[model samples]
Target: MIPISVVVVVLGGWSVLYLADTILKSFNSLKNSYENWLALHGLSIAPFHLRWQTSFFNRVFYKFTERSFKEIFQKFSVGMVFGVIAMFGSMILLAKTLMQTLAQMMEEAPSVQSDHVLQVVSSSSRIFTSRSILLSLKHTQVVVPGINLPVSQLAYFFLAILISGVIHEIGHGVAAIREQVRFNGFGMFIFVVYPGAFVDLLTTHLQLISPVQQLRIFCAG
Candidate 1:
């Protein structure tokens, strides 16, 4: 097998790619207003945007959204930190081990296609083709290539991480909207390969009309 991480990383990675691809492919075909909104701040979605990668799944999961965001984040963040440690040897070990994989995946990945044309190249996610920070997960490697293994182990691993992240950010947005605070924006980020969903806390703070509203948004994400 190609290794467990490979399958999942590819699947998760490509899922984002495919989603972006579909959205981009349909951009011209989409109605003006909707498409325009995406284009206007689409660049802001950089570094992380995997929520759509699991949107339907996220939608169904949120029905169980009775928990506060801070509580959930604290619990899951601790769990993920531990899980990554157990699976990848506290990141340090994983880093030492996957140096080769990193080299290869990157070498194989399209890293040099960036050639700007007019104003378009400077303004778009499709141009970069960088591995999504959200999909760049490490840990749960059940195989070793020539050794043969599947990345399926990382599927659930990533699903949890991804879903947790999506819920975290969306919860922030929902809480903010529900509280009638401004929506400066939210963004995605990556620390190593694990993904993180973060809301614009500073802007959120400024936009919040009151402590109760701020508390609502803060507690949610």
Candidate 2:
């Protein structure tokens, strides 16, 4: 989870940027200012009928990177397979835990006091053991000021998230394009206060694809 200070900073920045964007839409002068700024940098924004926003920086960088992206995917395909397996294992574990919890609850009956006690104890023991093992493997570090994480680590955290998000989305886009999937567009969004990226793929077409292809597309992210 993000620390409070980091959360505040993100919210504050989004507020400021969103206000500017709104103002740009309403005022011709401001819109020209935005256009001029982008023109100076050889960049542009393509607004869609969605809440998410996206920008194109340089076509040259995109073309070069597009070619390399597929190559990188091919090289890491084996690692990706392992990642998908691990992801599925985690889902199975979660589902099993939930099913066991529900079974324990349904088994509880007032008339069968002795049986209820045994079942509750057994279920509680299993849940606690599984939860403890999961928690033991989990760890977090704070980066926000006044948190467990030091302020100095903020840059590292920011870069980590930015790079991770970009790479993850790139995988989805690359796989979709490689499989000849019809793509609408891609963009970033600030849902409530959290920032994330998304790649738009047609669900109908996605359903038509093979399960192996679908798995590749999802696990790429």
Candidate 3:
């Protein structure tokens, strides 16, 4: 029987290809507003155009949180302090975990396997043990043909990224609107095989804002 690792690698490769194809196909149907916006920015990449929509999720944020983001600066005044605290705490945890992982890897004895085999084994061990960086780390063997990641773990990994990305973008979006900064729209970014999200802001308007206001907008994310 084939090893479970081999099966996972095969399935992960197929699913990623399928997802990329699906997203590319969907981009062909984007509305004219989004198309115009992309054109204005000289970012008219085929199969990766902006696709705008009226989302209730954001509507709720502006509605309950700060009355359409015009009040975002005031609403998030105290929240910025909390956001900074959270960011520092996260950084500290990441540093500690990474240091510990490195120390452990250094303490590990040399493997009986060949050099190539030993390198792969060591990378896989570190990825499985550390929770700090998620799946984007150099050591992770998620989507590559020779790398193996179980289907269940892959699903969880993608879900975590999606949730985190949405929350992050919302923080920036609402804050931008509250500061009276223009929000172009939100969109997905397909960086190689990895998927991510972002909020579009008018760079000129953003630069015109006060330094403290600009810092708050950035820290919201």
Candidate 4:
């Protein structure tokens, strides 16, 4: 049975979101004006997502990049190397963790079988225990509100993701600008529950740059 608190929280959240969307759509002139403003800034919006873009950060990128060529190259070169190392390290760690978890599950398989037999003998206790374990495993494998994570913590999770994304894109933008690549714009978006940021650069400019400079730009994020 679903908890009453969980039901209330879900309904409240949906109601708030619906009300906000309705208010925005109900004001025709306001909605049109907002859309026009977003368009002017190279932004766009769709259901469950909003993209805001602007070239206002170009000056900051340029300022950061304005340094001796050798110094800039050395800094980004170090970043590129460390980024490669971290990428491989993370892959290895993830693989190792997955192997360990699989081994542990295998070891627990007999216990699960035992539980099944016990369920047939003492139906109530064993059935409840097995169900609880299955539910916990399900929630562990997937993010489920009120199961894996509380509804109240969702806001902080999203906020942290947004901040990390913004910083990541900023790094790419700065690195591209330093490599003499054209920094077209920066943008952010929220797609459903996930938040992300991106930097736009001229493809032609990227193609013209040396491979080392390209590596720096790619690894900066």
Candidate 5:
């Protein structure tokens, strides 16, 4: 039998997807209606409605690594080094911020004894976990945060995933153009506000394209 906790998590995730689709639809409808109203008033519509045009490369480096990652890195050693450094930095910063916040809060509270405050601070993680465990009781509250989080992460990790994901999809589309394969615009998936880039090889997939070519295009993304 599937565990109840696991079932709740899965259903909660699906609800978040539904919420994102609704949000995107509403935004698009509003933009179109507003643009039509502006046309009636003789005001030109604003340019650059692109909320997702984030590019990752500065031409030179992008072309430099156009070849296989194996060719660029020669091995996975450099990537491994970068991954370790990023993780260590994130952990240290998070720990320092958490500690400073807790200390400041304790200093402002004179009625709470230092020992008692320390005990509560140490158990904060336990309290957070318990709150999450109780999430099934208010499923929408749990799901909305899950839905809206990736959009928030995109703002901060813009340098990391947004650029990379865009470049990755563009590389696929460029490859298809090079191979003379029929293609469509780049595909996209917008979840709540969390967007993802995808390659549009729908016709290629249906047609009997060589597995090797498909593999190359897929890997570009």
Candidate 6:
């Protein structure tokens, strides 16, 4: 049987999608008018995603990017260094977890007895034991409203995510403009429950830039 929480989540997601589609359709009586309006406003809507993009922030990006070459280089250089360090640290932690899991599996494999085959089989369904990588993961919980998290806190959570996403996109836009790449626009979207923001840069301009400049743009976010 499906859990009540699972059912509620599914129904809620479906309802949100339906409502978004309905609101979009109600904007214009004719399909062409709807399409034209969306195009004119830089709006795009799908079943589970809504994006509104515009070039209004291009000037702001340019202003922010108008820094001394030394300052810009130093900022991105520090960011790149920290990004690399974080990447390597995560890799090392994952590798350690895998090694621990494998070691535990091997230790347990030899203990399986022929007489207790059924018991061993049942337990073997879990490849990673509680003492392994799963030990940490098992305690991690998802922040579901009315469940693990209070419904009132949900707004704060979403707001934090939106702020972080906007800052991340702003960083990318500034880096792109600093690199002399064409900053097209900025957009934000909500996909199901996750909120994200993006900076649109011309693909041709990005491709034409030097590898170091590309690295700065990519790592800016």
Best by lDDT: 6
Please tell me which predicted candidate would have the highest TM-score against the true structure.
6
Pairs of colliding residues, candidate 4? none
TM-score ranking, high to low: 6, 4, 3, 2, 5, 1
TM-score of 3: 0.54
**C-alpha local distance difference test of each model:** 0.50, 0.60, 0.62, 0.73, 0.49, 0.74
- Candidate 1: global Cα-lDDT? 0.50
Location of the lowest summed lDDT over 10 successive residues in candidate 3: 133-142
Q: Over the stretch 1-221, how does candidate 5's per-residue lDDT look in tens digits?
A: 33467557656766775565445446876767755654454333112111222123334334444554455332233433554577798786666555555555555667457447766655765543332233223322222332544534535653455567777777666555444465544444444334466655558453566755554544444
In model 4, what lDDT does residue 133 have?
A: 44
Q: Can you give the TM-score per candidate against the true fold?
A: 0.32, 0.51, 0.54, 0.66, 0.33, 0.69
Better model by lDDT: candidate 5 vs candidate 6: 6
Per-residue lDDT, model 3, residue 129, is: 46
Our model 6 lands, by Cα RMSD against the true structure, at 6.3
Question: Among all windows of ten consecutive residues in candidate 1, which has the lowest summed lDDT?
Answer: 113-122
lDDT of 3 at 111: 42
Count clashing pairs, candidate 1: 7
Question: Which digits, one per residue and each the tens of the lDDT, describe model 1 over residues 112-217?
Answer: 5322221232344343344343124434353442344235564466567767986777767656544445444555555434566655434744464775455555
**How well does candidate 2 match the true structure in TM-score terms?**
0.51
lDDT string for model 3 (66-142, tens) is 65444555557777788778889988677656655544454464544334444554687764443333322435222
RMSD of 3: 9.8
Q: Give the better candidate number (2 or 3) by TM-score.
A: 3
**Alpha-carbon RMSD to native, per candidate:** 15.9, 8.1, 9.8, 8.6, 15.2, 6.3
Quote the positional error of residue 76 for candidate 2 in Å. Answer: 7.6
Where's the lowest-lDDT run of ten residues in candidate 4? 131-140
